[model samples]
Target chain A: MKITNTLLQMVKTVSITAITVLSFSAHAADDKVYRLKLAETWGPNTPILGDATKNMAKIANEMSNGRLQIRVDSANKHKAPLGIFDMVKSGQYDLGHSSSYYWKGKVPNTLYFSSMPFGMVTTEQYAWFYHGGGMELMQEVYAPHNLLSFPGGNSDIQMGGWFKKEINSIEDLQGLKMRIPGFAGEVLARVGAKPTNIAPGELYTSLERGTIDALEWVGPAFDLRMGFQKIAPYYYTAWHEPGSETQFLVNKRTWEKLPKDLQVILETSFRVAAFDMYTQALDANATSWSKMKAEYPDIKVRDFPPAVLAEMRKATDELLQEQASKDPQAQKIIESQAEYLKKSRAWTAISTKAYLDTQ
Target chain B: MKITNTLLQMVKTVSITAITVLSFSAHAADDKVYRLKLAETWGPNTPILGDATKNMAKIANEMSNGRLQIRVDSANKHKAPLGIFDMVKSGQYDLGHSSSYYWKGKVPNTLYFSSMPFGMVTTEQYAWFYHGGGMELMQEVYAPHNLLSFPGGNSDIQMGGWFKKEINSIEDLQGLKMRIPGFAGEVLARVGAKPTNIAPGELYTSLERGTIDALEWVGPAFDLRMGFQKIAPYYYTAWHEPGSETQFLVNKRTWEKLPKDLQVILETSFRVAAFDMYTQALDANATSWSKMKAEYPDIKVRDFPPAVLAEMRKATDELLQEQASKDPQAQKIIESQAEYLKKSRAWTAISTKAYLDTQ
Candidate 1:
């Protein structure tokens, strides 16, 4: 009887302990803090891109009521800008911001999320993503890599680049060394130009030091800021990238761990950021161009010669076809984008373009 | 002799011309065909406002390839809707559209604009305005004055109507006849119903049926649409009209004179109408209810339950003072609306209060 009583007492104690442990865990979970780390390829002050990150942070903080705090670190602070996707997917970082085109090697389909050479406008892209299932496809592309993506900001239409030598014809591109990226870079490479990939921060130095013969880094606003005019007198309006979209990518694991409320906040904030960034870029670009003309008279701004443009266009078509043939996902996105563009173009041609031409 | 010769020649020519003209010419401007008139209260659609009108004409002409041309008539249409605003402003039947809130005196802002007693949901309003802004703002206000206005469209964040109801305590509103438009009409009037101004088409029926207790029209949107709603719902929700904007107004004179561009082609092909009336309204309003329910379910979706919301907030104070002290332009609009409401409310609010509250 004594032995049985002792065994019973032990069991009772163990049961009580187990129950206490379970209750403690439940209580702790109620007050759990979710810390999210965000890595940005651009610096904190990089115009719309920077503003988007700040807005994202603000909304997340407000929505979470401080429960989920996101710490954003610049590119070099964590990893190289090009490596952001890999880092996030590998669990080295919880979140990341970068241009999807940068990872074209790893995910060819990502090019659609960014911009094709001479592709859709910002508004058209927004329509495609929000209404035309582009967003869903983008997620599908990122899913394989274990990343969830949201549009961060749009640079709108971009100028070609600052050229050390004027590109008068297709022949001028032969043997030229230009800092370009994604599909455009491939096209340029095929045309015999030595294509180089240079980060935005390092672009000015490379151009100034003659390491690169020419470089494409957004439009006059950012190009002017980087002092490209000082080194490259020939500024060519590439019109290669009509609209470039940057993205905010979160590690799937970290994203799933977030509370439902936090998720809403993040998505809403990013959407608002996208809207704000597009307008802000437009306003800034307008002012920047005026400033460039007034302040830097030596800088010559010219449109790409028709001959060169034609060649580039031809190359772009071929490159896209080749990419689509190899990657099914790329083909799917390209098809959808093409269809949307075709319809949108028909309407916009008469409405926006016609009016603009008349003006 | 030379001077006399010259003078004689001039006198002879003048006399002959005068006699010939007198015999051949005597006609009013209206007597001419191929005259196009466009009527809108403000300057021709600027970026945010008249973009539709501009695009409409452009698209129509392009589609028809210069075969059709439109001439817009700005402001002061024949006789405006809701007095001078709607009739001429609705741009004579060829094309007309604007926010429903403008005709609140007829239908009440709540019933016309998908209004909530406190605030309308953007999504629900979008759904309600399939024809876009709604037929109410136009039919009640403009149609009576020999005009027609379609439901153009709107963006987010609308102002609540202005009010004279001294809602010091929720109880003070027990029998109050308030000018509430859109969806708010059903909810508020249901609690303590009274008579509201219904649109010209629905007015006879609504009045006969005793649907609404009061009504409220738009501030800006109503101004653009016209102020019929104000006449019915005495108390207004000024907090709701912060960012509500709309388009669509035409003058009878201009409509009659419009060429193909301004007439059928431009009016029918208005790009903004195509975009905003359908796309913007649909997208914005689609997710509104879900978002509201998910975020603010407890946000009191009811009328100021007697004294529940009697506490005046900052927005109310500033809006009232601003309206009272108004700028010339703003004052003209405010005084007209305020005076009209004051007279209407004296009888509507008091007489209807007893019956409504008791019921």
Candidate 2:
């Protein structure tokens, strides 16, 4: 009886010790890890997009205390540049950074919000998104496709494009095959220009091989990088896309699965990234332009003729009106934007315009 | 002898067990709780500034995993609004949020960088600071005073002020007490207007009591909030300040003591806050103006007479030249800014201007 009692006590002691060890192990396991894959549209060397993505990933990782890690894969590494949207929406990738204009074929209305022909400036778009409910509207627009959207950055105003021939009037646009996208393409089509959508990687080759006659990428920073000066000498001012906003699209399922704090970290990080990218692009473009002008003097920078711009503006107004008539959501957004613009312009006319005129 | 050997082994075992337990206790003691104190100039009800401070603290706490926390104290909580700089620099608080123009008395050079009478827009200022090394130069200027600076928010453009009397010429400014700050104040003084610095919280009462003839506290947003229309009837447009940038100043010692990751988080968070606040001001101003016009139709909105604006412009040019001659650091920062502006303006003329005219 004594021996049995002693054996029973030993069993109880071992069981308690084992249970404590199991509890410790379970606590450690509760520290969850979420690994995210981010696909970027721009090349690895592009300062604004590349730096923003890298900074965002670093901040997310640090904020999560290493629990959430995002690995960015440049466009060519995972898929072609144009394939980013499909990959993220299909959940083949967790997130994607690309211009929303690139996916106009898949989501037509998305183009207006991304890069409207002469619509909004960087600050104005930021205002519309955050305060005017544009961000919520964008989410609603993208929700059908199983994606969550965030404005990653904005290239304020872009140069028109590099053309092999000078454009003197609306007639010059006939049979002109230009690489453009979104509503701008539709506007160009109205003037008899054939709009060809091509990825940045394929642009140089197409222009060089005569597959395309002209192309519009961004401003001097990106244009200089893509070596557009070599193939096309006449670089026209891109007044259509006043503020071309880039977007970051995350798979809805992946976004929903993230911890609440991680979601906040990601959103805030992207907001900062947008501001950083705008400033960087401005400075980098200035530097690149100086270099181009000094070393590549053969490249000519020109503004679009007034007559061509006048025709394009009329078409843009009609297009916007038509879009508003079709979708009440688009109508509501445009109406509110118009009201805000009217008030802002009144103030700007007296202050900003006055200053510019005097200078 | 065998018993002594066994006892010695048991003592060693007990010693190792005690040491292990004590080591863990020591580590637990080393875990610290750092409480950061923030001072802001806005009242608790101010939407963007007040809300941003609260949000920043919340984000910082969550990002630190609750190890680091921030406690924001609004204006008049512990000190007066204008006392922010001294309080922060003297270590009365770890952080401060206010317009740098408010501290022109101590740092005259800051006014040029913070907000000129008619300087860069919100986007242009962001570009200068982040990419054109304006931030680094600002840090250098503030280093001697034991502060680390970050751009906090922007009150994009400001109306001239609300006044009871009309001034048609430069001579009309003599003996008129106008509420203005920073370098603009100097220009006002040069033109014979009595420049008086008043806090936003005090502007209403001062205006009512006739302590000042005119006052400017941002645009329609904050002016409506303070009910300035009740005290001053004539709301004038085209004030000296076009875009007024606010700043976050941190105690140098406190900033240096922070972890590298926390530093990045703080800097990035402020940048986002600036973008957020600028838009919030825009949206809020629109709402506030409609309410003002409806509720108080007697309130008059008038433009700054061209005669007054012309004089102010001449004074501004003289002020710039004088400062450039006096301070080398100010000269260097201004030169870099001017050079960038020259190129940016040329680009904008061809692109942005062309688009706006056509649209």
Candidate number with greatest lDDT: 2
Give a tens-digit lDDT track for model 1, residues B12-110.
344334333332122111012332334443344433345555555554444332334456544444344333244444434344434445555553321
Tens digit per residue, CA lDDT, model 1, A1-359: 11233333333343334444443232223224467888888865767787778877765554333445688888657757678998899988998888888887877678789877766666556667876678999999999899999888777567778899888888888889899876788888877789988866788888888888998888765766788888889876645677788898989988788655456546655665665466456545644666777788897766776667767778888888887899788789988888776655433342223222221
User: Tens-digit lDDT track for model 2 on A131-225?
Assistant: 87789888888899999899988776788889999998889899899998767888999889999889667999999999999988888877787
Candidate 2, residue A237: lDDT:
76
- Give the chain A TM-score for each candidate: 0.86, 0.83
Q: Which stretches of candidate 2 lie over 4 Å from their true place?
A: A1-31, A162-177, A198-214, A225-238, A289-310, A321-354, B1-32, B163-177, B197-214, B225-239, B289-311
Give the true-contact fraction for every prediction, in order. 0.00, 0.34
In terms of lDDT, model 1 sits at 0.53
The two-chain DockQ for each candidate, comma-separated, is: 0.01, 0.25
lDDT of each: 0.53, 0.74
Q: Is the docking of candidate 1 incorrect, acceptable, medium or high quality?
A: incorrect
